[model samples]
Target: MWRCPLGLLLLLLLTGHVALGAQKGRGRRELAPGLHLRGIRDAGGRYCQEQDLCCRGRADDCALPYLGTICYCDLFCNRTVSDCCPDFWDFCLGVPPPFPPIQGCMHGGRIYPVLGTYWDNCNRWWQAGNHSAFWGMTLDEGIRYRLGTIRPSSSVMNMHEIYTVLNPGEVLPTAFEASEKWPNLIHEPLDQGNCAGSWAFSTAAVASDRVSIHSLGHMTPILSPQNLLSCNTHHQQGCRGGRLDGAWWFLRRRGVVSDHCYPFSGRERDKAGPAPPCMMHSRATGRGKRQATARCPNGHVNNNNIYQVTPAYRLGSNDTEIMKELMENGPVQALMEVHEDFFLYKGGIYSHTPVNLGRPERYRRHGTHSVKITGWGEETRPDGRKLKYWTAANSWGPAWGERGHFRIVRGVNECDIESFVLGVWGRVGMEDMGHH
Candidate 1:
């Protein structure tokens, strides 16, 4: 081989090394004049940085929440326009989020989103107008309105007491419905309007069912819940709400009339003022706004028509025992805890979904509500899972879920429905004693 000058050979080697260094430098352009490039992102094909606007002039780089300097090429992000890029690129280039499809159900002129963030869902419902908008309430607010009225707190001791009285392992019939046992006795579900009076409605409704059942269908009276809502102010707070125990006491002492006499005006307000002050019979002098003092405040002419219930008592929390109580005494009232997801319940045996928006552990329940447990049954879901559920009558209205009724998961104390069950006997008067 021809030997060249050593100095020249060394110079050649140095040149090669310098060229290689230049090539490496070119691969990573300085984000700023002196800053180094962050890196290459192959996911959506882009460059990102924490301190430099590397996404400028690029289509793919504008796909993320504007984190000041970082360029995200992700499909989407939650819209926080203040934190995002300018118009059009403000919400991940209008790309849909990688989330579950938002499901919704409409009732009583309100459309409720069944999934997604609770706040978003409620916001959507609030905008839909109707019951939710009528009260200017969000989903939580609506649920709170209904739940706030339940005054009975969950008591383990009470549940244990019921357990002792009832056999836990007792096998209940596979299926049973109170309406079937006593036809025409179970009245159609009543609408409580926007008022948080389900406690009273359920109490009156259950008592009415009991009256019919106990009297062997000889008497099927549609007791007035309006009476419980307006009057019965001792332990119960009219439209503000009341406890099942308080309602039972009122029924036992003061009895209500037919809904025909004293209808529900809880929703009927004068330009959104409190419902016409408990249209009561004026015992004072001249004829007052009420129908007549001739009848009880409940509006029943004959005192015999006025029915009362015995003191309310607790029942076993187990499903079997609950069924037995229904079979024997008609329907029982159930005070249940409501979660954020319950408002979207449309049909099927309702069980709280796994999606709990990181709610604090201390906030046990969003609210409480009471409903009448009319029956129980087992259902097979489309996925082939067996679902044991209780049929509950709601006061929302016939327009809501399954004609003003809902089926809830049973035996598991779902939504704490079985936590505090109440039962009572309708005291039979001479009139009732002979009718049935």
Candidate 2:
């Protein structure tokens, strides 16, 4: 046997498998002692695809094939094993397991636990084939512990329950509506060079959405594009990104002035000229404690794509049915494509995949065409595993484009982008576009 830490070993024995220590430094990965895996498969559908081996097949090899239902006992097939049902976020939000197995997990956002606990010991299915891993806490246990509740499909929505706790009469629609302090709505693409205020950008967008919806009963004129190009660069501690919530706070207090008044009178070369270092005056800078980069905000559902973040709060409950009812519906101020990541398939920059339709469908014609909704789904998995995912439509391109559509995890992986909503990032108090 190999040497293990202190309490970890005990927890492993009591549970079932040995939990591999995530290494920070560089060195060879040593397998845990007595870690017996069962039916593990590799990218070739025979054995485990050693990291050394897969690296060679990088560009060519997508990933391993499906390792059908594994009846656990060790780590995920070729991997090691664990005892306790590891934290859901730990695995889902963080790193994932090996190839083939992970491929399925990625598709459905089913972040399985390390060597499962006793009942449905996640460990038992360590190397099993094709079956969704049934690891970690059971449905009943979670409710008892007050951690989460089971939705219609068996998948657990911990945050949803917490969010709904205070509101007794809260309906599904209530939870998705715009919040207070919206100002910067950005359905269009604004060059970052034109602005550096990511906080201002998103805040304006939310404000625009709130104003339009509240006044006109639907989303009004599309907001400007130039927004949130610097908050993440200067004040925040990350790549030039922004958080919608933080933007909201700034809009409420500091209040963003119009670019017309501030005029980005920069040279052609210097598009977004750097202003004095960002001075976060509002106690509620961008998102939270202003670090360096743009992070996500609270109540957000996904971020992997754009369609998933489509402006649903603006539409009434029967909006879809009504739209279906009336074939005469025409273009509005904007169109939302709610994919896993909140991206607008604008031309020039993000046009990796142009509209496949030979005819340009007039997305750029009137003031109405702006957003589009792609992926959207519930919070459960097919195997009845407790999962939290983002449902969005994807246009991965004609290559892997499934009927010009795609869906992915909402919170974990790249999908966690719920913070891009109108109230969350756009502006409030603008003209409304009548919907209902």
Off by over 4 Å in 2: 1-205, 217-221, 225-246, 253-376, 379-388, 391-436
Overall local distance difference test of candidate 2: 0.25
RMSD of 1: 18.3
Instruction: Please provide, for model 1 over 130-158, each residue's C-alpha lDDT reduced to its tens digit, 9 standing for 90 to 100.
Output: 22322333444465465535556456234
TM-score of each: 0.63, 0.28
Clashes of 1: 0
Query: Which one is best on TM-score?
Result: 1
Candidate of highest lDDT: 1
**For model 2, what is the alpha-carbon lDDT of residue 328?**
18
Candidate 1: TM-score?
0.63
Q: TM-score for candidate 2, please give it.
A: 0.28
